[model samples]
Target: MLRWTVSSTDSFLIGYNDLDNEDNWVEADGTQHSYSRWRSSEPNGGVLENAVMMYARDADDWIDVNVESSRQFICKADIGASAIPQPTVNPSCSNGWESNGGSCYYFSSDQKTYSQAQTQCKSMDSDLITIDSEAEWNYTLGYIRYRYYTRDYWVGLTDIGVEGTWVWENGGKEPTGTYHWLAGAPDNSGGSEHCARLDRYNGYQDASCDGAIYYICEDDLYISDAPRSIQTTIQSTTSAVITWTTPLQMDSQNADLIGYKFYYWIRNKQSETTQSVTISSPDTFELVFDSLSPGTTYEFYMTGYNSYGEGVASDPPGNFTTVSAQLRSENYALNIYRIAKGVYLQSHVIFSTEAITLQHCTNICTGVLSCQSVNFHHKATTRAKTCEINEGTRESYSSDVVSDSDYIYAGL
Candidate 1:
């Protein structure tokens, strides 16, 4: 049987008759499998006529063969898989490295300094490997399994060539996620080159880019990515939160995932209403978003990424709804008093307590028409915490407000 990594993109050529289009290839025994096309002409015999037959265009006289004729046929992949060859930059001087994020990197640790390494990576729309998360740290550790203490591999994270500012080949200068250090690394040692890397044993380390170390590069793709594992919880009349996971990391040329991009929708007329949200930096498997409209049904899902490209979104996503305020927690001290005519919500902070941020207030004012107008004590660490929700239509205060020492908002 022939092996194939069928991209969902090029399946049209194979026709709808292909069995792979139906579901994940798994047998009753739970053995996963993939499909390969047999030579058209070969599968041409038998009353079932299941033997491969030559494609009409390529067959010419072969098409005249009797339906029962037995002829050896050659296989040709109708899918674009056999189309153009991927362009390679240094196919001769460089070797390929398979990244945990599902990408390919090419590095020549034989080079002496960083300049050459940058040049090589640049030639291929990529740069030296830059580690970002613990997942990535583990991914890199396995990639260099063949190489010993030998030398430090070159990563794209650096400030030396630019000084004071560090930028990765990933288009942004700021570091995302958590930063790690191998106790005392990126020291520039004697002040030469300062490239960052994840140590296999522990922490991050800096090395000269030109120091003869194998490296990795990245690729990125944002188009055609779908959302996955969607879950929705509708709380009250004005808001909801959507959560999901991705199939492959975004922009991954290869390596563990870095972050994700989310897109959501609500059925509109005969179509779905669409919107996008980017969670710039997050770990694998989870995300929480609250601030959707009340009583509106929404579908949410996400796609993953690393430094290179994005993969497809998940299938069989879930749906959710936003309930009414009547469905909210009456346990919020059941404070149902009139702020002005609009009847607003206010959580009493009994003491100067925990620190709070605007995100907390925005979350509280779920489904508000204007979340931007809310005022929150972003750094409040005491009972001073307060978020003034702008209801637009307010009435004079007619009742005493209840106290909520926690002053927290509800999402469900």
Candidate 2:
């Protein structure tokens, strides 16, 4: 993989040298120097040509050039012990994350404010997508056009901290490639447009932070082998909620996972079903399975799918039994209400930091699964504001440990 060339004014030393007083040459490795192919009058001692060199244009011609003169050189290697094989894993991306060139990207279907989108991406262990290469930029533009149909996406480039000083999400300087900026771009139009997005024209355009738009998240491809550590949390007579840790991919692997394949079957039954759900964002990892017989046990496993292929399936399927039909009832609240000064119902369905209002938390929880109770900890001027949706009535959590007295502890 390497080539060596000596300077024209100086010669490079090889392993061969005249070791004996009689001008008998020998190599550094003690090999007999039996080969000779000198050029016409190459060994002219008056020129002090003690070292040797091969003719640059000929394959076999040799010349006794100056020891310090520069010329082409060749190297040889002997086979050594067998090299140790490196460990390799089937690289893949997590559900909802697309793989591309040593990275996992997630384009959010749910739109959010610029700050909210950045927070959401960070919650999923990623940052706003950065377009560092022409290929990456073109691919992003094409993908956005195909999926969003002329819609815009928030890119990581911004000059908010210092006007006209654009920087990437990872604190890198401006990209060296093409900016693809639209005409009159970063015009500082209104003097408030600091954030940037990939516009429909495949150009980088500055926009206001308040504009709600789908964003992109990028992280290293180091997810696990598959969706593992699955657990069946809550189950009714006909439905069950399953949660699992997200799948992981290796750093050197490329995975373009779009979603997950949920596999389930009734224990000891011949029938089975496989359902696939597209994750709207990288933050989603739970799914609810419905329409099951009462008091029946079911086993389930999951696998992630991407453009490359399907990843390894879960090792052991999670098992859960639904309650009896008589034991199921809809006796929970569907709205957010104040439970106590510093207490909240346990058995939460999901948690979110962007849920700013009680209604927002209620709507998010009620749409997913059976929402019994909900809590909204709204504290302005702080990032700790959150929404917690309670599905089961197990116990209550102390509000002091979660929120302050000014927090809005609502339950439903």
Candidate 3:
């Protein structure tokens, strides 16, 4: 019996096939080849295995194999050696840093605590690496493993601010579905582990912030400037549209403009209640907000972002008020009547003044052309009375009208 030097399963495809006729081989690109090297009785599979492969177990001789079979193949380039571009040092990055995906990365040679690493990065005008997407994570992992091998690297993730709530140093909360932690990791073991590090063998693991480790630094190539020319249009009684122009200085070469972040709330109630929405398209310049209270005023501002980070907000937020439901018809007759007691319409004031009685407030509303409602605030002890003329009626802005014991609402 003869012993084989190579495994029986070890085979590699050669770019030659005879699909048209048996024993008539041709190159993969449809050209004929005259050179022939085949194992004895090899073209046996015929039509079923028209492709040729080199079988290692049979002294690396050519054999017919199924064309659809998965096997490693060889490749040859037609270009001359000098035509291929040679790798050159990237001018955008510093001496020891590497440029990738429009960002610069620096793998530190010295070990330091997480805080020390962050300080070192900041000294160089960069930050400890914050992996934003899976592609970025994979690239960092591959680079470290290939270059440094099996080493722990400090990353910019910590829950020190609020335990179990990991946030980047830049204050962005950890986004879901973007990172995979090592199994059962970030356990905050012994109530002391707060910093995160990349373990080359598995994934991220929580470690003590004081523990020394190698680190990676990242510098963003560019960030989008703030959006410009913010404008708003009332679309309906319960809906409004906000539009803005793209920033003029947004760069598309080094980094990609990802989207815009919109911040809005009822004016004067921003500290109490604010909402934000992220429009995840670079080309979108408008956003529509529905389900708004009729005649309620809203203040909004927008900021653009790229893969690096969010930019500054648009200066001086724009404001708009939704149209009143009853005011949709232009020909409606003005007839003032008592709508509700202990109620007032908020944030649609056309004018306000002191009034001695409820009837005096109604008379003031009748005189103002834009006034559709009136709120009379009366104090029994001080004998003080005030009137608020509103541009929205109680029927049109029911949601904006709220109960207040000292006020009365009258609609036109």
Candidate 4:
């Protein structure tokens, strides 16, 4: 529900629905009002009108007239009641880069191999620039024409993983219907070219991966600059509310922004993986993440997006932990060993520990929310030296024969 307020000295249209009688005036919700704003000569209509319109001459000036009467009205938006609070607008780019299309681009001056160039970009938390549209391609071309007309620059396009299956370094499939390759380009010249390069000379072409070349790096603008004053509230043991301030200008002049993306993960499990939530709305600056692990600290970061692309990610403002959930019977289930000899669960390991007793191993498996089984192994040099805690139920295990008795498998 939203609330509206009248300006101090501005006339406006309100949700009043009643006959001309000031005695019957009420708000849209049928709430009775003790206050009156009628002008000295207002409500002159005798049972012939049923509408109210404020006048700008004075703060309390109002006039009652025919329902069909027309007049200019002032409009106001309530910030406190907005579904997503209005974010303070602020946008920026990192040093030595220019912002465009919701992203930032850096044209390197030095040359390096395709792999090395990619590594350099990664070191900056960016990647080799990938042109997803003709506009972006033209933008890059314009930059090259102005500053590096004849110089070759590396792009993120490649077919290195599989011949003839081109993909962007960002993990997107090759674009179709609008290829910008030069005549007879990407012919896999010399049977060794697997990387792609861009220049004014020949739009784009395949080159040797080991070939040294300058490269461009693309960083999402919103993600890099990020929103400010991020505030988070723990809603429950499994949910939290996150809010941030972004100035209206954070949106492109055309309001190309489409949404904000939230990336979060448990602090200890960050290296393994992260989860994401995308709230699609140019104006939505607030979000709620649910079904999160309880009693564990979580780190959160955000980035804004538009039709063009995603902006730079905001530095993680801080961390928040949900309240612990009430303990349940399943959480206290006994860790009874299930015997499965000569077989080891494959590719299910979530964690591993060294030199722990079988009893301790069982306890470890039970303690983890995802662990349902454990694999204990002993090498010739050290007896029971390793334990592999695995996810997934025992029923889903695919057994692989391991003749070594020192390698034992158990599930709880």
Model 3 lDDT per residue over 62-167, tens place: 8787665468876667867445466666687899999877678899989999999998987777778878777787788656633554478999899989998888
Clashing pairs in 3: none
Candidate 4, 1-412: lDDT as tens digits = 1114444555556656453123477765466778787888776753334556776557456776555445555455567765646543325567688767767788998999999998898777677887877778777875664356557899999998998777987555674233577677778978898888985463778889998988998865543345667898765455567888763233222244677888888887886768888888767767866557778799878877765567756764479987765444763455356856555776787656654576656655555566677777744266546767778545775454345566667776
- TM for every model, in the order presented, reads 0.33, 0.32, 0.44, 0.36
Which segments of candidate 1 are over 4 A away from where they belong?
Answer: 1-95, 107-109, 160-167, 171-180, 190-193, 197-203, 208-213, 219-262, 265-412
After superposing candidate 3, which stretches have Cα over 4 Å from the reference?
1-79, 86-92, 174-179, 224-301, 305-321, 324-412
Residue 380, candidate 4: C-alpha displacement in angstroms = 57
lDDT of 2 by residue, 152-243 (tens): 88988889899988888655566323447877787878899989987755678889988999899887443325775777864445666777
Off by over 4 Å in 2: 1-91, 175-179, 222-412
Error of 4 at 274 (Å): 28
Residue 190 local lDDT, model 2 = 89
Best by TM-score: 3
lDDT of each: 0.46, 0.62, 0.74, 0.68
What lDDT does model 2 reach? 0.62
Candidate with better TM-score, 3 vs 4: 3
Lowest summed lDDT over 10 consecutive residues: which window, candidate 4? 247-256
